[model samples]
Target: MDDDLRERVEREAEKHALLNAVKHESDADVGAVMGPLMGDNPEFREHADAVPGLIGGVIGRVNDLEYDEKRARLEELAPEELAEIEAEDEADEHDLPDLPRADDHDEIRMRCAPNPNGPWHVGHARMPAVIGTYKQRYDGWFCVRFDDTDPETKRPDLEAYDAILEDLDYLGFEPDATFKASDRLDIYYDHARKLIDMGGAYTCSCSGEEFSELKNSGEACPHRDKDAETVLSEFEDMIGGVYDSGEMVLRIKTDIEHKNPALRDWVAFRMIDTPHPREEAEEYRCWPMLDFQSAIDDHIIGITHIIRGIDLQDSAKRQGFLYDYFGWEYPEVVHWGHVQIDAYDVKMSTSTLSELIEDGELDGWDDPRAPTLKSLRRRGIRGEAIVDAMIGLGTSTSDVDLAMSTIYANNRELIDEETDRRFLVRDGNEVPLGGSPPDEANPQLHPNHEDRGVRKIPVGDAVLLESDDLPQREERVWLKGLGCFQYTRDTLQYTGEDIEVVREGDVDVVHWAPARESVPVRMRTMEGDVTGRAEPGVAELATDEMVQFVRVGFARIDHVPSGVADDSSDDELVVYYAHP
Candidate 1:
């Protein structure tokens, strides 16, 4: 470590010592002593919140010394505690409670229901990981369900479902089974019929605006007093395409006079003229609403647990009432706060992200910055990193502004160890335009990891180096991980791979390549603008190969087009996501 950094660490350690001294004092006010210590240093204060146990470590270190002696020594000079603080910080990060146990209990089945209107976002990404974490740790089973009841908002494409599956697969989420609300129309119809027979459902012929006004005014509709047989027949007619969209709706029989508007005879089924993605438009005209479908399906599917965001907490109670009305078993409810993105100061919405992608401002659903599972995966973020970040956030009943950096940092730590180093030099200009001399060149494909071993570059009388490496003034410079070199007016000599020779006059010591030898390559990164080249042979690299371009960052070989011979028009494509 640098001297300045070492001194800063030492000062922090001494503060830790002083804080410990005050804590151990007979009649000492702990906060009074530590508050000043924290107030004096921002770094110490920020880390102190996360590393509470560090105080214990500091106390232990001072055990051998007398209390007064320790205080005196601490006051004299600061001590280094960088490593200890970092270790403690890492220890507490992302350690959430174990999932609830279902061993002795049969009531632990849960399902994640996502509307298949678009691809999954980071907010939706949490569902599978959280549910999977619980299922594995608590011996629970998770089901993937599609809430596809609203045909108006639903697109007539299966690509969304396919993309959802792809996102889940990328994150290693495999549900025991998949269910769609559209598939169980009969079950919903049966429940609606039961409600009708029980006087819990009725057909409403009120116009849209009139119904809205009546609902808003907390007044019972005149149709609520209609005979059960009449309402049942009307429901059948609605189902038989006897009514057009918005002409009639099957409203549940609830207290319209009740202050709670949601329970005020809400519509349980609606007539839609639009076609369903899973079922043809001509097959049926009436469809059960979300609440109605969810209530019945949860009972029939034997779901023992309902884990969802806090926004659905009331929906759980509403569903429970339906369960009670039917005398059916209801699942236990566990609701967590919403995952709020700090950037927008609002809940993360897939629709918003999709709109951005559609407009061409964002790359796609998998754009590294898109906050989707596939985006994170393509950015080389491990699933475990996301799990750790979410679980660490803790389950609170209050909304939180989730910072994107937290996940990125978590991802960096998780991926750092697995990434093999490769040198990549961009905007290079130092090497001679002709190439490095045969004797002075010894290029290695993979550094620090020989298991992924060597990829020999064609280093003859022609080669390239990053153009930015060239300094304005002629000076001896190191080629990083390679060796040193000396530069002159417009070029630099190919010094032996290990050493350099000084040359007179100012010259740009930049990353450069032998004119036609090193093939220029392009890549698509999140932040954009990555233009580099490797030996023409790099075009032969197979797709999806993880490689590090020397002096540049690590990248995945995306594809090498066909007909691009090993020695010809090199068209190797590398994939990077905001790598610095």
Candidate 2:
């Protein structure tokens, strides 16, 4: 490469490094810097191999400088990029890119199509978040379309349709309109007839193996040459239940000699004996394939744009034939790569999760282990956190891997200041007091918010301390908000009530609950169940209220032993741990 081009690449790479380091207050990553480094500088595109080394060299220099130095260098190098960072910091974290050919259209129309075979998983939430953003950006109408056509394989659960709408509302992405593919069977059949009449589609009675052989050999099936009238007649019979399941099929016409076999003639519709879950489709046995049905609906509903995974790029190629035959303008399409959440080890397959639930291994869809939106919500994960985490991913065509820590951090920011603190002693031991202390100790419910109130914990003869937090031999410990204690020989002796002395001596502060008013706390965490003892006030909080366990972590009150208010009967306080 020429010296001028090489110099340009280095300058661009340095700009990203400085901007990244200044914004994050940390060392810039080679992978993180590479995207903008090459994106803004097309001159360096041909030298892809050299870009990483250039970025690496730049990151080292950027990392070595102080935070202020990095900011100053970035402003000096590219003042606009520094200003952009400041603006981004003050605004929302997720700023999606503009739509392609957005200005050419007068109005924007979008859809988030999901198969209602099961409740929405975390991965399924992305489409609505992203597409809804565009809908809002353009003041356009958005539709939540259910692609619940495959009854025999992915049978749509009747409950999932409503459940998905509830999730959208929870995520603040409620659609302006909603519909299902099963309700539009006649629409698909109408398109199929026109397609056959236009000589763009045909019905094949050959077995699956025979068709595969013909397709692999770059040849059409024997029925491919049938006239339009004859083909339509056969298609009608196929839909009229003349053929049993898998006995006949309708195939869309593509390039017979196409190099990619998948782009070659593909199945447009197939017969299935298993009725659709929805009553409207119960009488129908023939179902239109996903691509054909979705493509037709996109045109019929005037979808201006389509967002899909790059893996299904072939759908566009295959569906283009039908569009051309019908002389319909195809909607602008954008393909995004897969998003692999590193936190979830299981594949985001509904069938796999359903089987596990049926086997009694999973405690239904909302189990903390299941990677569904319901699970995250029940575990005290806010809807905003899920939306932010997904929108922050943007619509990159390259596969993106992410850790769930980002979501947890975002959720913490939203709930940390609001949730009141409570003391929970896991696996407790009764420790007697050595001195005559006050009858009770009151700790601030929230350290920062004194106006909220305090937990009036009665100090009896002894206090319940977590077995793990018990003062070691000769070690001094401060029972938070109560008093200091020193463990000597086999006794825990109270030292003094002064907080300054404990801080001066650098004593360990451990959480404790009054032994007299203790309640059995059953905590459900992602790792496993934790049986703990909490102050009586913990059981008084309303269910679903978020609270933080002192020295432990944040958790939501799932259920308090029923009738705790009516009598002295003690019941377990069940809570779900959020995160540390």
Q: Where is model 2 more than 4 Å wrong at Cα?
A: 1-94, 563-570
Cα error of candidate 1 at position 491, Å: 1.6
Model 1 residue 299 CA deviation in Å: 1.3
lDDT of 1 by residue, 336-425 (tens): 888775533223577777678789977777765566777667656666767767776666668766776676566644443345434344
Report RMSD for candidate 1: 9.1
How do the residues 188-245 of candidate 2 rate in per-residue lDDT, one tens digit apiece?
A: 9998998898898988989999988999999878988999999999999988988999
For candidate 2, the lDDT comes to 0.82
Model 2 weakest lDDT span, ten residues long? 42-51
- Measured with C-alpha atoms, the lDDT of residue 352 in candidate 1 is 77
Clashes of 1: 33
Lowest summed-lDDT stretch of 10 residues in model 1?
499-508
lDDT of each: 0.62, 0.82
Taking every candidate in turn, the Cα RMSD to the unseen true structure, in Å, is 9.1, 11.4
